[model samples]
Each structure stands twice: as C-alpha cells, then as structure tokens.
Target: MGTLKNQVQLIGHVGQEPQVTVLENGKKVAKISLATNENYRDSKGEKQTNTDWHQLVAWGKIASLIEEYVFTGKEIAVQGKLTSRSYEDKEGVKRYVTEVIVSEILFLGGNGK
Candidate 1:
C-alpha cells in the first residue's frame, strides 16, 4: 500500500482485570475492558463526565505483562488497531463485535506501579 492506516491510540483506565485464556495452540490471549472518560461543561454550566468502554486484546508478551502488573482501575496507554468480526451464537444468531488489538501498552500514574 502507498500509505499506512487503521491505527488507534487510547489512554484510559482498565475497567477490569485481564482475563487470560490459553488457546489450543498454547498461545495465551488476554482480554480487558478499558474506560476512557471525557469531561466538559454542560449547557447549564455543570461539569459532566462521559465514559466510553473499549475492548482490548493482548497476546504473548503483552498478555504476560498485563497479567503481571495491570489491574482494575489502572491507567494505561495503548497503541493498536481496530478489528471487528462476526460469529454465530448458539441460537444461530449472528453477533458482531469490535476490539482493539494492542501492540504496545504503557502504564501510567503513580510511578507506573
């Protein structure tokens, strides 16, 4: 391709602890929910905060690191790309979802502990 695209960056708090699953091929995948907050003043001169939740997936070394030090409420910055897929449910219903596949994760706040 002439130019690169499909990149995303997010700085947010970990909504929950990473859930790790081992694939049949022995590769581990970690899934977590991240919450990004937006703050602004409303029309009535009141502050409002809005939170958006994002799905994040990490594999291999990143997964390992997430399991080691990451936790619920921890702030992190991630560089990744957005991905979406569809799958059939048990009732033959199609379910669609989107996620961010993180390549790099930086721990933030409180000396990154």
Candidate 2:
C-alpha cells in the first residue's frame, strides 16, 4: 500500500529533445514534455482524439539517460511521483508548477530515435 502512494505511470511521445542542465554541484537534471493521446468516439459516433502534455523531470543517472537517448517523438514509459513547487519569477509573481519526477524509464516502440 505504501508503494502505491503518489505513484504515476505514463507512456507517451517525447515532445522535444530533453533539456539537461548541470547544477553547480555537477549533478545533472533533465526536463522534457511528453504528449499522450486518447482516442474515443463522440456522441455523433465520430472519432475524436485528445492529446495532453505533461512535464517530466529526471535526476542523476536517469537524467543522464535522457540526455543521451530521449529525443523528439521518441516513445517511452515513465514511472514516478507527482510533485508541485512554487517559486517567484523575475517579475516577483509567485508561480506554481506541477511535474512528474521520473524514477524509472522504459524505451518503447523499438529503435527510439
């Protein structure tokens, strides 16, 4: 039960090349957008597709893997937990952001290029 707490799993296409940054301590972090699509039939029997974008973040070795292999349109699966943080922007306005902190990643669809 404890393991299931705050767990999130998503499989999607990478929206763009991962942005990897090295911290002042030489630790690496990576960020990317993933797009997931859902297809369904409308009331009129017409097919419709909805796409949702999610922000994903990775640290350490996971970030390194993303820096090397993850790219635009590549399909992958990630398991992580949702995290929210607030920060003040340059304009002095408080901003809140929600992101999935990736712990596990699986390359899918073969030859993830």
Top candidate when judged by lDDT against the true structure: 2
Runs with alpha carbons beyond 4 Å of true place in candidate 1: 1-4, 111-113
- Pairs of colliding residues, candidate 2: none
- Give TM-scores for every candidate, taking all chains together and pairing residue i with residue i: 0.91, 0.94
lDDT, model 2, position 32: 99
Least well predicted 10-residue stretch by lDDT in candidate 1: 104-113
lDDT of 1 at 85: 99
Q: What tens-digit string does per-residue lDDT give for candidate 2 at 1-113?
A: 77679999999999988999999999999999999999999999999999999999999999999999889999999999999999999999999999999999999987853
Q: Write the per-residue lDDT of candidate 1 for residues 1-113, one digit (tens) a residue.
A: 65568888999999988999889999989999999999999999999999999999999999999988899999999999999999999999999999999999999985545
